[model samples]
Target: MEQGRAQNESAELGGNGHDFRPCQSVNFTVHRVGKQGTKLQELDTPRGLACSDTSCFVVDSGNKRIKVYGRRGVMSGLFSSCQTFSVSNSYWDFPTSWSPQDVAVDSSSADGDHVVYVTDLKEKVVRKFSHSGVYCGVFSDQMLRSPSNIAVDPLNGAVIVTDRESRQVALCKPDGGLIRRFTVPGVPRGVTVSPKTHNILVTVEGVSQPAVYTPEGQAIGESQEHENDVLDHKAADLGDLCVDEEGNIIVADRRNSRILLFDPQRQFVGTLLSRKDGLRDPCGVDLLCDGVVVSDLEQHCLFYVRPGVANTSITKPSQ
Candidate 1:
């Protein structure tokens, strides 16, 4: 049993000289974490990145398919939800068009464990599926338009999708209820969620953009690059983002061909990887178990980094 632990305890002890109260509260404890592996598995679809049931998931743009990898970066299976079936031949239904840019998994599902979610970019909808590549359902709320990226609030399973051309983000319930549509100041590209927090981060191609979000869709942080004529922030065009175990942020600074690590305060810590490290046009990033999985969009290859070990490469979007 844990209670709210007061912050700034020294203020409580010497508050006689001034008006004092607990400024903040912190909770510490253990939790049942889903496992994810960091092994460098073969690569496919170096585009949409998500974690479904503690495993790394990707929508390989080039392959026109999705791939699953376990916590240790073991190849699990290929996503076959979008199948071709003639109405007169097979008993299946699919959207008129299916083009996936990003994928997500519903973390709150209890039925058909490992339920996966993906954005149908061309169809302007979000499609739902099972971990085994079965067509589960579809989310076509009126709010969705050119949906590109998908993220889910693991706590409540709220679905978040980004529409690249529209420069907006849509929030919906797992059952396909439209909650809200948010306008991102810049052209938003990739997006991510922090499991330990409800805050969502989005990458934008706008000049000086970093990430902007609020609990209720308000812009929290503006683009950090090009503050003024004085000094340019010069981080890079952020395309993908992920939070590591230590709550540190890993950003794929695309155009600059580098990846950056930032503290919780959104302050730049350092470059985690770069083109000098054999990264080329690194667009999407997902941190698996103890290693990092990176997608080089231009090269169509997947690269994994392990401590003290050489990085291994796999052909992009393997069939």
Candidate 2:
């Protein structure tokens, strides 16, 4: 991965060793993949993003497939709908077509292998896949209307799906049994499970702020205002979101064409990437060990960004 230089911008924070003073902007090194073609590295309307320790998964929505990339941004593999039919299944009950909108990876298995869960908007079900892209089975057909996005709980391997038509988030077992469902204010777009606190983070359509919920469906918190910002800190169009191990929330603000950072308390930190960084309608994001992988719809590509705090010592104050 080629390293890019960090662009400096001023930001303020309160307490937690991040005082309300002008500190150096967050640093980032970006690596991107894909172009306007049908190659393995090319993408079409890439939407949902999820990352395991070794690979990042992209929901190539327009292509009706999922593309996998290694940590260094190399194209690894891809998988599309399976057409195998069961003898016991009726003609109409067989898998005909699929439109995948989002994907999630479960890497908490005891055997060290990861499992993939993909939400099919056309089928209204979540399909399971092995780590290397083997079709396992489909689940949640009876519970979802139009499944848009999905996530896996690291603690228990529960699959959480956001049903757009139902305006609900359904938590299901790995085997596809429904555990419970909760209603959100608007059409839920993105859903993810936090590894640190085990809380669920969800983004709703037309809602400027992301909402936090407990695993048991209790409302907890939403994005809060930043003290120093004169403009509204809320996102214009929110998309997929993921929480790092430290509980820091990374959100894809689509309309704003940028990626936002929020503390564990959902307080706005700052813009990590924006239009200046070549983003045009970023729709999905997932965290890597040292950075994040983002899917841009308009750009039709994926970006791996490693973020860092700028060094205040070398930064010159604006005069």
* Highest lDDT against the true fold, candidate: 2
Candidate 1 wrongly placed segments (more than 4 Å): 1-45, 71-97, 110-112, 207-209, 227-235, 309-319
Q: Write the per-residue lDDT of candidate 1 for residues 58-88, one digit (tens) a residue.
A: 7665444566655322333222222212112
- Give the local distance difference test score of model 1: 0.58
Shift of residue 272 alpha carbon in model 1, Å: 1.0
Give TM-scores for every candidate, taking all chains together and pairing residue i with residue i.
Answer: 0.71, 0.80
The lowest-lDDT stretch of 10 consecutive residues in candidate 2 is: 84-93
The number of the candidate with the highest TM-score is: 2
Where model 2 places Cα greater than 4 Å from the true spot, the runs are 1-26, 71-96, 222-235, 307-319
- Could you tell me the TM-score of candidate 2? 0.80
Candidate 1 scores a C-alpha RMSD against the true structure in Å of 12.8
